[model samples]
Target chain A: MEERISLSHGSGGKQTNNLINDLFIKYFNNEIISEMNDSAQISLDGSKRIAVTTDSFVVNPIFFNGGDIGKLAVCGTVNDLAMSGAKPLYLTSAFIIEEGFEIEKLEMIVKSMADAAEEAKIQIVAGDTKVVEKGGVDGVFINTSGIGTIYENTNIKAYNAMAGDVVIVNGTLGDHGMTIMCQRSGIDIEGELKSDCAPLNSLVDSMLEVCSDIHVLRDATRGGVAAVLNEIAEMSKVSIELDESSIPISEEVKGSCELLGLDPLYIANEGKLCCFVSEAYANQVLEAMKKHSLGANAAIIGRVIEQVPQKVYLKTIIGGKRIVDMPSGQQLPRIC
Target chain B: MEERISLSHGSGGKQTNNLINDLFIKYFNNEIISEMNDSAQISLDGSKRIAVTTDSFVVNPIFFNGGDIGKLAVCGTVNDLAMSGAKPLYLTSAFIIEEGFEIEKLEMIVKSMADAAEEAKIQIVAGDTKVVEKGGVDGVFINTSGIGTIYENTNIKAYNAMAGDVVIVNGTLGDHGMTIMCQRSGIDIEGELKSDCAPLNSLVDSMLEVCSDIHVLRDATRGGVAAVLNEIAEMSKVSIELDESSIPISEEVKGSCELLGLDPLYIANEGKLCCFVSEAYANQVLEAMKKHSLGANAAIIGRVIEQVPQKVYLKTIIGGKRIVDMPSGQQLPRIC
Candidate 1:
C-alpha cells in the first residue's frame, strides 16, 4: 500500500512511521525493533566480549538484477562482524538519499533491508537520514555500523594463521561481482545466476561450532581473496600456497571471468568466506560449511606455510607458479 | 612541503603518508599522530567515565566562507561529546572522496581537519577512505567519530531541565549558515562577518569545572535554536519560554535574515551552544563562556517552566507570544 517516496518519507512524519512500521518492522519482526525507538536497547552480558565494525556502501545502480542496495547494506555489515568471530546483535544504518527518488523503490529497499536484518538476526537499531538535491546524491549511500558480542572463548585474528593452517572457502568466488556485472550489462544467460548475497553468520557459526581453532575468518569482498590472503600473510608473517586444481569455481563464473579478463581471485564475493584452520581440523570446518546451502561449494584450496615470508603463491593448472598478489587497485568498480 | 591530494592520495602509497604527515600531523602536532598509523591509540585511566558520539559532515562546496568540511567534521563530533559534559580525548575521521578531486585542495582539507582536531584538544585516532566514481560522488564527504572522558560527577541530560532553570546561548546564532549562504550566492559584503565555527569544548570544560549543576547542554544546529530546544523539551518533557529582547542576534545576521527572508531561529549554528542550567549556576556558566572569543555575546535568553509539557514558546519583540516549533523539513542541507 506504499506509494512512491515523497519528501515526507524522510521527514520523520506519517510517511516515515508508516514506511518503518508497515514494511520495515513487518519484515524485520524482532523484539527490540518492535518498539521503533530512536535506538535499540539490549542487555549485554558482562562475560561476553564485544566487537565493533563499520562499513560504507556506495554501490551504484541501487537496485540491481538479483539484489538491491538495502539488502547489500545489511548483509555487508552483518558479514563483516561475523568474520571477526562475533555474533552481530545491533546495527546503525545511516542513509544519504538523493531527492526525487521514487517512494515505491524506497519501500522496496527498506523492505529488503528489513528482510535481510531479519534473516541475519540483527536489530537495525539507530538510523540517520539526510537528503541532498537530485544531482548532489548518487541515489542512495548507506553506512552500516555493527556491534556484536564475541564469546570469551573465541580468539580470532589475522595473526593466528600459523604454518600449515588449511585455507577453506565456504563457496565459489566471483559469483557476487560477476552477477552484478552481468545484470548491469543486461546479460541474460540460459541458466539464471544471481548474486550469492546472503547472511553468512549461520555458516560461520557452523564452522566455529565444528572447529573452534579456526585461525582466520575473512569475507572475500572489496579487494577480494588475493587481498585477504595478503593481509593474513602480512599479519601472520607467513606465506600461503594455493593449489589451483583444488580451488573450486563454477563453470559459469569461470566463463564470465575469462570473458571479462577478470581474475576470480581478485573479484569480490558475498555470502561466502575464506577461513583458515589448523590442518588437523580443516576437514571438520569444511564438513560444517558443506552442510549449509550458502556453503555448498566449500573447499580446502590452500594452506599457510613457512616459505616466502608475507606472500601468497598459486599453482596453475599447467604446472606454472605465479604470485597471487593483493589487488593493487579496484578490480571492478561498484561491484558490491 | 606537502603535495596535493591526487588519486595517489588514497592509493595507500607514499603520497598518502606525505599528506598525512606534512599537513595533518604537522597541524595536529599531537604526539599520538606524529607517528602515523591506521589509528591513533590512547590509554585512559580505567576510572574515568567516557562519553561517545559520532557525526558525519557532508557540507557542500567543500570550502565555505569561513570554514570547510574538514574543520566542521572534527568540531561537530567533539562538540557533541563535550555537550554531554565530557572532555574530548580522541576522534576517528573517515573520508569518502570522489575520484579526480584536486590534490592540493585535499591537502588543505586534511590540514584543516588536523588543525581543528588539535584546537579542540582531541587526537585524530582511526580513519578510513573510500572513493566513488566521478559521477557517483560529490567532491568529498567526511565522517568523524569521537570519544571523550567524562568526569565522575559530570552528568547532564535534557531531561534534567527543571522548572525555573535558565536557558543560555553561548553566542549569536545564524552566523555559520549565513556565511555559507552568502558564499554560495556570491554575496559580497564589507567588514567580513565571518562564521563562528570555533570549538566549544574549552568553554564547556571551564563551565563544568566551575558549575556542576548544569541541567542540559545542546548545540543549536540544522534547525538552529528551534530544533535544539524542541529536542530538549521532548527529552526533558518540559516547557520553556524565551524572551525576545534577551536573545542575541548580530546586526549583520539580522540584516542578512531580512534580505534573505529567512528566520534567524530556524538558521544553523556550528560554533554556538544552547544550554539549560539551574538558576543558581546559570550566571557562573555564562561568565565562563564570556571569557572565550566565540562566546563574547553569550546570554541567558530563556527559562524552563512546567507548562504545556514539552513545548517552546517565544515572546516576540512586539510583545506577542508564539509557540516555536522545529522545522519538519531540513532548513539547511548537509550543514554538518
Candidate 2:
C-alpha cells in the first residue's frame, strides 16, 4: 500500500479496491462484508432478509445538468439496494456543510433530496447535519445509507453469475461521467449532455417481476461497467465477453468520450445497471426493463463464458477482441 | 433562518434546532422522524422492531485524548441506537478522506473503529470511501449509520418522560468538550482531562435488564446535558428541576471549566447519557448503571415536574433557582 492516500484511492477502481482489501476488509472482516455485494444482506427473524448500503457523494460543481448532489446522493444509495434485489424502504442522509454556504442552495439541495426519495418510493426517515468551518470542507458532502427488504426467492448476487448467463445494461453508459467531465472542462458540446442519474429501484422491480432467478444485478456507478464486470467475473470465477456494438451509448456521450479520449465502458453512470440472467429469461427481462422510462434503451451487451476464467474481453466493431482491465488510477476526481 | 449557515447551526443548540425544524424536518418529515428521537424506530414483520440512526463526526485534530474520529464515529451511532432501547446490530461507515492523508493514520483510525465496533458488539457490515482534494475536506470526516433490534417491551423515547420521572446521568460532564477545547487552545491543564468517549450499549442493556420501563435515554453529546434536558422537557411537555448539588463532575474538569469560563452543562460529552425513569425504579436503574465501568459516576440529578411545561430549571447550591435556557449559539466548534 502507498504511504499516503491519493486521488486514485477514491476512483472506485484498482486503488480503491486495494485500500478496501488492505485496510477496511482486513479490519472490518466479517461474513457479510466479505461477500461485498452492492449491499450487505442481513437476516432478521430467522427468515426475513434486509439489505443495507452506504455511499458518500463528493461530486464537484454540486449541481450538474440533470441532477445535483442531493439527487445523486439519494439515487446512489437507493440504487445500491436495488442492485441487491431489494425493495428500498428507508434512507438516512447526513450532510457535512461548510460554514457560510448559502442557505438557499442548501434548501434547494434538501428539497431535491426529498423529491428524489419520493420518486424512489423510499422514506428519508433519519438525517443529521453538521457544519464545518470554511476551508474545512468544500461546499457540502452528503452520505446516505439505505435499508431495503429482499424479495423472497430472489437471489441476486455478484458471485451468482453463471457461465451461460446473459449480460444486459439498462441504458446508455458514460453519460454521467462525461457530463461531469465536460462541465468541469467548460467544453462546449453539441446537442444535450446531461447526467444519467435517476433512481433504479422501480426499474429493478419491473425486471425482477419478469425473472426472479436473476443471477446478478449491479449498478455501474463509479468504476462503471468495466469494473462491475471484472468484479463479477472474479467473484463468479467465469469469463465475460462484451459485444461492443451491442452496448448502448448516447450520441452526445459517445461524441464527448471520443473528443476527450475516454472509454465509455469505464465511465460512471448513476441510472444504468448491468444485469446478468439466464439466456432463457434474457429476452423477457430485457422487454420488462425496456418498458421503464429509465431503461428505455436497454440492450444485451455481453455474456458470461467458461473460457478464460476471471477475465473480461470486448469484441470490437471490427471483430478484434481486447481486454477491459480494471482502471488503475484516477481519471477524473470528484466525479461522483 | 440565517442567509448563510453559521457554525452555530451545527452547534447542537438553539440555532441547530432552528435549522432542523425549518429545513430538514420541514422537508423530510415522516412519522418516525417527526418524533425527533435519537433514532428512528421502524417496525418489521408486524411485531419485530428495529432502530436506525445516523451521525457524522467532524472533530478537529482527528486524534483526541481519549478517542479519535474513528472511535467517536462508531460510539456516536452505537450510543444513538442504545438510546432508542435497541441492541445495535450493524453499522455502515462512509469516510470522506482528504487527498495526501497519511495511510498509517487511516489504518490506525480504521483499526480503532473495528475495535470500537467489537467492544460495542456490533458489526461494521458495509462501508464506502471517497477521496476529495486536499483542500476539499479537512483530514477525514466519517459518517456512520447504524441499525439495531429494539428490545421487547421497550418504550424508551425522549417524549416518554412523565411528570414524576427522575433524571440520572451516567458519568461526569464536559470531559469531552473540555478535552477538545483545551487541545485546540493549547492549554496544559494539570490533571487528566480526556474525552469520556465509550460505547454505552452494554451499560444500557444492564439498565434495561434492571428496569424495562425506562422513560427517556439520551447521550449528552454535541450540545451537552443542558441541551438534552431542554429538548426532553419540550418533547415531553414537562418541566425538569435539577439539583445543582447532586450533579457529578470531576475535579479536574470542574477546574478546567472554571479556568476557561465554560459551563459544564453546555459542554459536550461523548460517553455520558441522561436517563429519566419513574421514581420507583430510579434506584434500581442507578444501581445497574453503577455496576458498569462507564457509569461508575452515575447520580440522580433531577426530577420531572408539572409546574412549568417545556422548561428546565437548575437549583443553585445557595438556594436559588435559574432556568437553563437552550444554548443560543456555538460555544466550541468541532468539539465532536
Candidate 3:
C-alpha cells in the first residue's frame, strides 16, 4: 500500500501516472481524462457557446463534516460559471501540495473533486501539480478553472439585479462555516453540525430553465449574504431591502452562531446560492430551486429598488431598520 | 517596517487594497491589473499563430537563485506557453510557505510574482495561498498556471517533426543547472553561479516572423535534452540522431557535474529552448536566433530521421551509438 507521497510522485514518471490512475482516475472517471493527454481538448458546439470561470479553494482542513477540499474546489468553480447562466462543461485543476503531506489524503481530495465534477455534469479536463518544501506551503491549496456552454443567449451578471427584483436564497446560511469552526475549535453544538459543501450547477440549470430571465445567481461564500448583497447593490447601482423574517435560517446554525459570537449572514455557505430575480419570475425560480437537494430550504428574502445609496438594508422583525454591511474581514479564512 | 504579512494583507479590506496599490500595482502597473477587477478581458487580433518554445534558468543553491518560489513560478509557466507558440495572457500562482517564515520573506516572494508578471507582459489574474504549520511546510513553494491565446491557424505539436528537420537550441546548455548546483553545494566556480531565468516570448516573436513553419519547439527543462529528445522521437514516431560533439556545454557546468557525480544532461534548465525546423530553412532560423541576446550560443545539434527503431541515439566522439532515455525517477526535486 502506498503510505504517503514521496518526492518522486511529482517527478512526472511512472509513479505520477500510477498515482493518477490508482487514485484520481478511479474516482474521477470521465471521457476527457481517459486520454491522459497534456491538456484535455474540449470540442465545443459553436451554436451552444461557452462560459469560463475560475475559483481557488483553500479551505482549512482537507476533510470536513459533509465534504472535503477537493469537492469544494470543483463545486466552487462550476458554480461560478453556472451563475453566469452557463451550462458547465470543462474544468482545469491546479494543486499546490506541501511536502510531507500524506499521499492518501491527496488521493481522497482528488477523488472528491472527480465525484463533484461528475455530479455537476462537468469534466476535469486539465490539471497541474506543484510541491513546496515543508513549512513553506500549506497542506494543499486548489485552484480550478472551468469553461462551460451558455444556454442560448442568457445574460446574467452581478449588475443584472434590477430595481424591484426579489432576493431569494437556496438554503440556510452558516452551516458550512459553523461546522468547520466547531470541528477546528472543539466546540460542540446542541445538534450535529455538518458542512453544506455540494455542487449547485444542476440546481442552477433547473432554475434557469423556468426563470430564464433570472436577474442574478450568486453562491454565498467567504463574506456570505452580506457580502453578496453589497456586491450586487454596487453592480446594479440599486438599493436592496431585506426582510429578516423571510430569510431562511435554521435554529441550529443560529444557535451555533450565537455561541461563537458570529453573525450567520457574514458566515460562509457552500451548498447555497443567493439569487435575485424579477418579482414576476421569483416564484418559478424558487420552485425550481426547491426541487434540488442543495436548495430545498429556498426562500425569498428581499427586493431591490431604485435609490441613490445603492446600499443593502435589513428590516428586523421588531421593526428596526439597519444597514447590512459586508463583513469587514474574512468571517472564515481558508473557506472554499 | 512590517517584517511579515499580517492578517491584514489578505483581509480584502484596507490593507489588502493598500498592498495591491503600493507594491503590486507599482511594479506590475498594467492597465488591466490597475483596474483591480476580478478578471481581465483582453482583445486579440486574428492571426496564424501557435505558441512556440523554451526556458532554462539555474536556481542557485540548485534552488534559491533569486526566487525560491514566486518568481520561479511566474517564469516557469510563462515560458511553457511561450514554448507552445501561444501568447500567454493569464496566470494563476500557488504558494507553499513554511510556518514561522519571516512575513517579509513571503511578501518578497509575492512581490516577485507581481514583478515577473509585469516583465513577461502577463497578468497575475488568479492566485492561491496556503500556510502549512511549522515543520509541515517548507520555506516556500510556488506553482504558476498561465493561459495564452493560440493563433487559430498555427498548428504545432511534437508529433509534427519531419525526417528532414534540423534541430537547434536557443543557447548553450548546462549553465543554469551548473550555476545552481555550484551555489548550493558551496562550490566557488567563478562566484556563485547565477541562474538564467528569463522570459522568451520576445525572442519567439522575432523567430516566428522568419520561420513560422518550424516543426516543433520544446523547452529543455527537467531531465533536460535527453528527455525532450525521447519525447520528440515517440511523438513523431521518427528516429533522432544527435552529434555529441555538436551539443554545447559550459566549462563551469561540466566541471561542477564532474565534481558532484551528476550528469549535465539530467540537470534542470529554466530559460532555454530546443527547436526543430525544416532543413531547407535551418540556416535562416539560425541567423534569426543569432540576433537575439538570449540565443548567443545557438547551435544546430541534431536532426530527425525515418529510421525504423524510432529511438533517440547519440553519436559519441568515438562514433558509438548510445541510447538516450527519459529519466527513470526524480533526479532533483523542487528545482522549480
Candidate 4:
C-alpha cells in the first residue's frame, strides 16, 4: 500500500476498495459493518429492519448545471438506502464550511438540500455545522446519512444476483462525471451538458412496486456502472455479460468522453442505478422504471451469465468480448 | 444574519443558534427537526423511539494530547445520542481527507475511532471516504451520524428542567478547549494539558440506573458549560443560579485560562456532561456519577431558579453575582 494517500484511494474504485478493506474494515471489524454493503441493515425491536448509509459530497464548484452539492449530497445517500430496497425516511446532514463563506450562498445550498429532501419525501431530521479557518477547506463539503425502512418482502444484496438474472440500468451513464470534468476544465460544449444528479428513491420505489424479488439493486455512483458491474459479478460469484449496443449513453456524454479519451462505462453517474433482477421480472421492472421521469432511459443492457465466474464481460460493437475490470485509478477527483 | 459567515457563526453560541434557526430550521422545517434539539427523536414502528444526531469534527492539528479528530467525532455524536436518553447502537462516519495525507496517520486515527466506539459499545455501521486535492482541506475532517434506541423508562429534554432541578457536571471544565488552544499555539505548560474527550455513555447509564427521572442531560462541547446553561435556561424558561465555587476547574486549565484571559465557564470539555435532575434525586445521581472513572470530579454546581426566566446567574467567589451569557465571537475556533 502507498505510504501517503493518493487520489485513487477516494476514487471509489479498486484502490478505494483496497483501502477500505485493509484499513477501515480491519480496524472497525464487526458483523454488520464488515459486510461492506451499500447500506447496513439493522434489526430493531426484534422485527423491523432499517437501512443506513452515508456519503460526503466534495464536488468542486459546489453549484453546477443541474444540481448543486447540496442536492447531490441528499440524493447520493438517499439513493444508497433506496438501492438497498429501503424507503428512505430520514436524513442527517453535516456541513463543513470554510470561514468567510457567503451566508447567502450557504442559504442557497441549504435551500437546495431542503428541496431535494422534499422531492424524495424524506425529512432532514438532524444536522451539524462546522466552520474552519480560511484555506482550511475549499468552500463547503456536505455529508449526509440516511435512514430507511426495509419492506417485508425486500431482500436486495450485491451477492443476490443469479446466473439467470437480467442486468438493467435506469438511465444514461457518465453525465455527472463528464459535467464535472467540463466545468472544472473550462470546456465549452455546444449542447447543454449538465449533471444527472437527481434523487432516485422514487425510481427505485417504482421499480420495486413492479417486482419485489429484485436480486440486486445498486446505484452507479463514484466508480460508475463498470465498477458496480464488476462488484456485483464478484459478490454474486457470477459473470455479467453486457451488450454494448443495448447500454444507454447520451450523445453529449458520449461525445465528451470520446473527446477526453475517457471510457463512459467507468465514468460516474449520480441519478442512474444498475439492477440485477430475475429474468421473469426484468421487463416488468424496466417498464415501471421507464414510466418515471428520472428513468426514461431505462434499459436492460446485460444479463448474468455463468461462463466465467466473478468477472464482467462487455460485448463489443465489433463482436468481440473483453473483461470490464473495476476502475483502477482516479479519473476525476472531487467529481462527487 | 451577517453577509458572510464569521468564525462566530460556527461557535455553537448565540450566532450559531441564529444561523440554524434562521437558515436550516427555516428551509428544512419539520416538527421534529425544527425543534433543534441535540438529537432528533423519531418514533418508528408506531411505538419505538430512536434518537439520531450528526456532528462534524474540524479540530485543528488532527491529533491532540488526549484524542484526535477520529475519537472526538465518535465520542461527540455518541454523547449527543446518550444525552437524549438513548442507547447508541449504530454510527456512520464520513471522512473528507486531503489528498497526500499519510496512510499511517489515517490508520491511527481510525484505530482511535474504533477504540472509542468499542468503549461506548457502539458500532460504526457504514462509512464514506472522499479525498480532496492537497490544499483543498486541512488534513482530514470527520462527520459522524449516530442512531440510538431511546430507553423506555427515560424522557430527557433540555426543556424538562424543573424550577427546583439541580445542575451537576461530571468533571472539571475547560480541559479539552484549553488543551487544543495550547497545542495549536505551542504553549509549554507545566502540568499535563490534555483533552477530556471520552465516551460518556457508561457514566450516563450509571446515573440513569440510579435515577431514571433525570430531567436533562447534555455534553458541554463547543461553547462549554455556560452555553449549555444558557440553552437550557431558554428552553426550559427558567433561570439557573450557579455557585461558582462549586464548579470544578483543574489547576492547569485554570492557570492557562487565567494567563490567556479566558473564562473556564466558556471552555469546552469533551468528556464532561451537565445534567439537570429532580432535586430529590440529585445526590443519588451525583454519587453514581462520582463512582465512574470519567465522572470522578462530579459536583453539583447550580440549580434552576424561578427568579429570572431564560437567564443564567453565577454566585461568584467574592460574593458577587454575574450573568453568564453564551460565549460569543468565536472565543475558540476549531476547538471541538
Q: Judged by lDDT, which candidate is best?
A: 2
> Model 2: which docking level applies?
high
Task: Write down the lDDT that model 3 would get.
Answer: 0.66
After TM-score superposition, what is the CA distance of residue A200 in candidate 3 from its true location, in Å? Answer: 2.3
Supply the DockQ value of model 2: 0.89
Model 3 C-alpha lDDT per residue in residues A4-114, reported as the tens digit of each score? 344333322234345455643443344533433212223322233445455556677778999999989888777777776777765666665555667557666777776
Specify the poorest-scoring 10-residue window by lDDT in model 2 chain A: A302-311
DockQ-derived CAPRI band for the predicted complex in model 4: high
Q: In model 2, where do residues sit more than 4 Å from their true spots?
A: none
Off by over 4 Å in 3: A1-51, A134-138, A149-154, A188-191, A235-237, A305-311, B1-70, B92-143, B182-187, B305-311, B317-321
Q: Candidate 4 A-chain TM?
A: 0.98
Model 2, first chain, TM-score of 0.99
CA error at residue A26 for candidate 2, angstroms: 0.8
Output DockQ, candidate 3.
0.07
Where does model 3 sit among the CAPRI classes? incorrect
Cα deviation of A32 in candidate 2 (Å)? 0.6
TM-score of chain B of each: 0.84, 0.98, 0.78, 0.99
> In terms of DockQ, which candidate is stronger, 2 or 4?
2
Q: With candidate 3 superimposed using the best TM-score fit, by how many Å does residue B216's alpha carbon deviate from the native?
A: 2.3
lDDT of each: 0.70, 0.93, 0.66, 0.91
TM-score of each: 0.80, 0.99, 0.76, 0.99
